[model samples]
Target chain A: MLDYSALRTVAAVIQTGSFEKAAGLLNVTPSAVSQRVKLIEERLGIVLIVRGSPCTATETGEWLCRHLENVGMLEEELLKQLPTLAAPDEARQRVTLHIATNADSLATWFLTAVANFTKQSHHLVNVAIDDEDHTAEWLQRGRVLAAVTSLEKPIQGCRHLSLGALRYRATASPDFMARHFPDGVTADALVSAPSLLFNQKDRLQARWIRQIIGRELAGPVHWLPSTQSFVDASLAGMGWGMNPELLVGEHLKAGRLVELRTQTPLDIPLYWQMNRLAADRLADLTREVVQTARLLLRHEGR
Target chain B: MLDYSALRTVAAVIQTGSFEKAAGLLNVTPSAVSQRVKLIEERLGIVLIVRGSPCTATETGEWLCRHLENVGMLEEELLKQLPTLAAPDEARQRVTLHIATNADSLATWFLTAVANFTKQSHHLVNVAIDDEDHTAEWLQRGRVLAAVTSLEKPIQGCRHLSLGALRYRATASPDFMARHFPDGVTADALVSAPSLLFNQKDRLQARWIRQIIGRELAGPVHWLPSTQSFVDASLAGMGWGMNPELLVGEHLKAGRLVELRTQTPLDIPLYWQMNRLAADRLADLTREVVQTARLLLRHEGR
Candidate 1:
């Protein structure tokens, strides 16, 4: 049988990113936390942590953390059934849900789902940001219990739900359009103009270009990792970028921003994938996400 | 002498995250690109790229990238002097500069600095996000040519200049304040009210708490990582958070949000640190950053 107390100790270390802080949280000595983790690693014959200035979970550690999350769900349900065993401090009773999503979604509509879920449930959330195409790797590695990703296929131990497509438009300020695309939005002109990229992992602009222009063309690119700043950079005429339709809608309507071409919008399908062990317990969150997606995302024939 | 072609190959691989993609960018075959990288690695006796689904820069890889950034600056100057030797495509002339900054800085004023800089210069930017207190580590680890950081002391080989302080207020929607702090703001109420945290690295809220309340008290926290979403979550009555005064000023004045207390504010001093090697060539960007900071950031007695 797994020792849950020591497992909780391991989770705390990963959560706080230091044995000292975890010790403070659990009211134990730092050495005791370290010793407990070392003992668990020895018993399992696997290294669980990459100890550093900020400790991170290894592959085995992520699996253990996933197991702990399901166990936490079970315990929280029991606490609801028998309220006598709960801690007086609401903080102690609440559990933080670890999830992952793309920055654009988080900037647009993912928060609506998460905020609504938090308001109704006694749970907090820790959202790790990654590119849409890469968040599935987080779920596959067991780093997050659930994720909003671009992958259609489900992982081995997870349930998948279609969340509809996130539509993107190659948007630029009117001034940028006049400066860079005076000859119209063409593959030749695009080779010179700068484009806003989320990061190296972001292929939205490349994918959108290939879809519209029918080929891969390289251009000067500015890397603005923050989603809001990416839009702001586009508005300021620093670069043309693929902005989510949801975020650029008002600006588009107001003519503060304009699309590069009339019919060049790219739609990337998003899906919600979660570990099957926690699927039933996280139904409320899943419902909120699906409902929010239905209301905000682009749907077929809509 | 370092093989400039091979170094460029390493940079291309890191920028594109795959040998095939990098090969396409350089108009070369994938195996040739791979062999060149392998030869350079063998000669250097250090691993540069961590080969993965999406490749990453090893510590030594970061150092090489930094050196390349300095060289890029010199070559851009040479291109200005002699335009006859430049590539026909403007994309080949422009270089991407990697810099690190905190998310709040990026959301508020950092983009303004970068935008103004890019408008005049042909160079592009790539900004990496980390906590302000930790961004200097990026500079130290040779991961970036420059960074915006909170550390006052000078880094070993970098030029450090104060950009001024970014002021933060404990803010929330009126509805949140009423529901969470019914009996006035006290330690007891704070211990029960949920707080907003950016992530585990964010010690701002806790430090703010220590400054105002004079003790360590625990509370429930919702982890919202997006800077814009963090503000929106505050507006939605999710929790009280440390919001940048720049972002919340209009919201505060318009009655969309309010401060938790009358006199509680946290001012984090920010600094711009860059490699001295690139300082002379990047004087234009450094000037724009400092000038923008002077205009937007709060200074002593201001």
Candidate 2:
């Protein structure tokens, strides 16, 4: 029901933050970009974008953008299947897919999936990083066509695939453990010792503390938001916090970091959520992600 | 006068996103935390925080938090100057300072300044990274006590000190240059070539294209948001992009990357802006940052 070209123009405007800039990127005149947006709004009979210094999409516009992205993926798949119907120049234009994920996943096995997908498909990726618990919000707001999230439920109109569990261990540097917990991890020592947190929204440390000590942890906290930096901070004896088993495996093996020896490691099950559009490219990407995740990540039940 | 302890409690609730969590951090009862927040709201006659799954500060509450942080810094400075009047327990608590900066700065010379300052002062830092142009908004919103920003003018109540300019050179990996621009960087080659960008908000590549070809660029762009990842992508022959001279100097020297040899490298002037509070700690921090910047960054007119 919507003009795919016009929708593409709308997305370009929001992404580039100006009609003029979008025109430059789209290789069209500024007036042409403006007219396309106007045409879409007229056809839809709703305000799509609030024109400003930096354009922002209205709620309806965001949904349209997401739809356009999915449609683009479907078109790519169609052209691949039926080369006779494709334009001669169609192969030159690679589809750009926007995905939302957490920093840890991106720094770990997720990129392996992305690299594998891009090798076989003519698609470029734009990744938006947020907390695992919050990545679904980006998908709901239509900022991303797909998301890697911890939520078990799928967003409306989206299909969910379980990627498997990312196990995490509470770890600290060897020197830090000896210095801070010489007498073992008592409540009194934990109350005075320093701890590292990924962010205020991160509840891994709190959950781990409640599990280990059966009480809340009131400690000096250092918030490092970057995944690599969080690992570095922990390795440099700044504090101890949960690190993904995949990331800390080398350090643990090298004897640089020591596990706190809890009863069980924390396992956060990740799900791949995508719009339920019949797109071969999306399906291919989903298959690659699932296959790669299963190979690298821990199985949910096992 | 407002009770600084109550003000701190209010900040913790907003930061940790729950009164119960803030109580645990403060080593107090949840009811006591609620009472303190209520007392402050009544005294200020303004709604400070919105109760929600994750709490957020109202506009007025943000200002109060900033004020509380400044007061804490000033109190620490006062105790340092007149140790005789200080409570014995005050020395044990390190004051935490929140600052806003750009990623390039953090990945380059800013850590040295932080390390030096931490060694000399009993202060821990929490840094929030935003674009250099937008860090002023964080300062204006009272989310940070200081910011490293590109704006020359100070926010209404902040002091601005010029920290010199960061020079950027457009560079590409040796192999990529040989493949894409074999005959040198012509406008035709640029039109069809893949390019790297930090994000959609980044205009460095477009600006460089306009400067060189006198027209806007219409090319394929890969948006890489992480500084280290951006550099790695460039190094891995993903595409050509502008890199900070400080960051890519070694690569340039080692012949891993080659500069495109533009007419002039882009030099973005950076300034340190802080609230105009008479705190010696703030003054000391400003001095160290400026000193480190002058040593590493290019001077204004040079």
Candidate 3:
């Protein structure tokens, strides 16, 4: 077994990026964290870390620390379900949920889903917005109880439920589309046409083109990177690209932009992937999401 | 940010079904884990857990504890990489790398890969064996820094490199194959033939049949969950199913087991996916695995 106290102190130090900051988070003097690491190293007979201005874990030390952390997470999750097993005075009162999500979901219906459950759920959520492709990884790590993912398969011991499809329209301001795709908008024309993307990792545009042309997506595509800018770039007619229907519904209705591909608009089926342990919470959240999807996106033909 | 310390303690209590056991693992008085959880609940303004003989986290509480675990894992991994950032003492040595791998890799080249990284890598490896499909989920929860996964794309902030193919051949004792596959079996005959699998999660038999016959695999397949048992069952003629080439090499050479297909094996391309962060120890370990693959399994073809 590894020395978890030493490990925890070391973790706090890394999180704060300095002994001083770690001390603040831990509510201990910086000297205490320092002394603990020293004693741990001496006892273990090995160097567990490398201290720079920002600090890092040595391979062996990091491996142990990572294991310790996993154990901690598993234990914590188990505790939530079995809190009443502890002594009366020791019974837990509040629960915290950590989730890795995307900015769109975080900013949009995700919070509403939480609100739907909050009346009966006395829990706080720590939402970290990352890419959808990687959100499911958090579930595998035992970090979050649930996640909104593009993946169809569930992680081990977890279950997956389809929420609804997110419809995307390839729209551009009429003037901008005319400026860039002036050659009567052939597939080839749009292939190299300047388009916007959420980030370097975003491949929505290429994916849209592939569906239409029946080939791999390979071409010159511009990256807008940020959600706001992606929408801005499309509205500005800098390029033609897909935009989430919810985000640009009004614009499309007002004719600010023209839908490029009427035949094929990108509609990704979204799924709610979660650990199977918390059956009630998962079911509630799933219901809330499905209900929201039905209310908000039913007309989009999912 | 939640009180991870409290969550860890509470989780331990539940796993061990006793605060005493949890305390022993936590290196604290059972009272400490007990008190910490009480305080955590008070601070959170919610009833997070229910205490009893075997503790259980409430739906709300489990949610939070899971998040705490995730952050704890990432934090632990980071600290291990940069331990000196906390103490900077010359005493700490030996970097650790925790990896969750499959049984075959652990019993075979995984250790060989470990042996290859001698210089600058005094590693403490925590090897976990599970199905390939589920390994990346472990990586996502911040449980391990790297993993051998079936995923083509990398996890968040991680890079994925192909490790070539893992070819599995359906083999059986020559006597067994001769008796079972009389008249040299056709694809359709496989539906009724008994087969072997690594575990309940093992789907190689179904996958292989699907690949060859373009249909679902449904038959009287025997379930030998352990790596050793799976091999033994096939050798004993209990069934014919997919087994790794390395384990079956000698038998194939000795004509003890007959290959089931003309294009007789299923090839699953393996990938070495790791966090993008540079660690001398991890780099050295990766180098060793790559070298071993080149020598042992590279020529099998992807």
Best model number under lDDT = 1
Instruction: State the local distance difference test value for candidate 3.
Output: 0.63
Q: Tell me the DockQ of each model, to 2 decimals.
A: 0.59, 0.36, 0.01
Give candidates' CA RMSD values in order.
Answer: 2.9, 4.2, 30.8
What's the TM for model 1? 0.92
- Fnat score for model 1: 0.61
Which lDDT tens digits does candidate 3 get at residues A1-302? 76766887776554334666566545678799899988988998888767864466777765565455445555556777887666342222233355556645543455556545533443434454556777788778766678888788767898877776677788888886676667665766764555555543455665776677664333334433344344555665555667778778899889897888554567766678877865455565577767876665433443
Q: Which stretches of candidate 1 lie over 4 Å from their true place?
A: A13-24, A27-66, A81-91, B38-59, B78-92
Better-scoring candidate (lDDT), 1 or 3: 1
* Number of the top TM-score candidate: 1
User: By summed lDDT, which 10 consecutive residues of candidate 3 chain B come out lowest?
Assistant: B87-96
What lDDT score goes with residue A156 in model 2? Answer: 92
Task: Give the DockQ-based CAPRI class for model 2.
Answer: acceptable
Enumerate clash totals for all models, in the order shown: 0, 0, 57
**What are the lDDT figures for the candidates, one per model?**
0.88, 0.79, 0.63
Sorted by DockQ (best first), the order is 1, 2, 3
Q: Chain A structural similarity (TM-score) per candidate?
A: 0.89, 0.83, 0.75
Q: Candidate 2 lDDT, tens digit per residue, A131-246? A: 89889988877778789999899889788989988888889888889888999888888876677777767877778888888877667666667676667667767678889888
Q: RMSD in Å for candidate 1, one decimal? A: 2.9
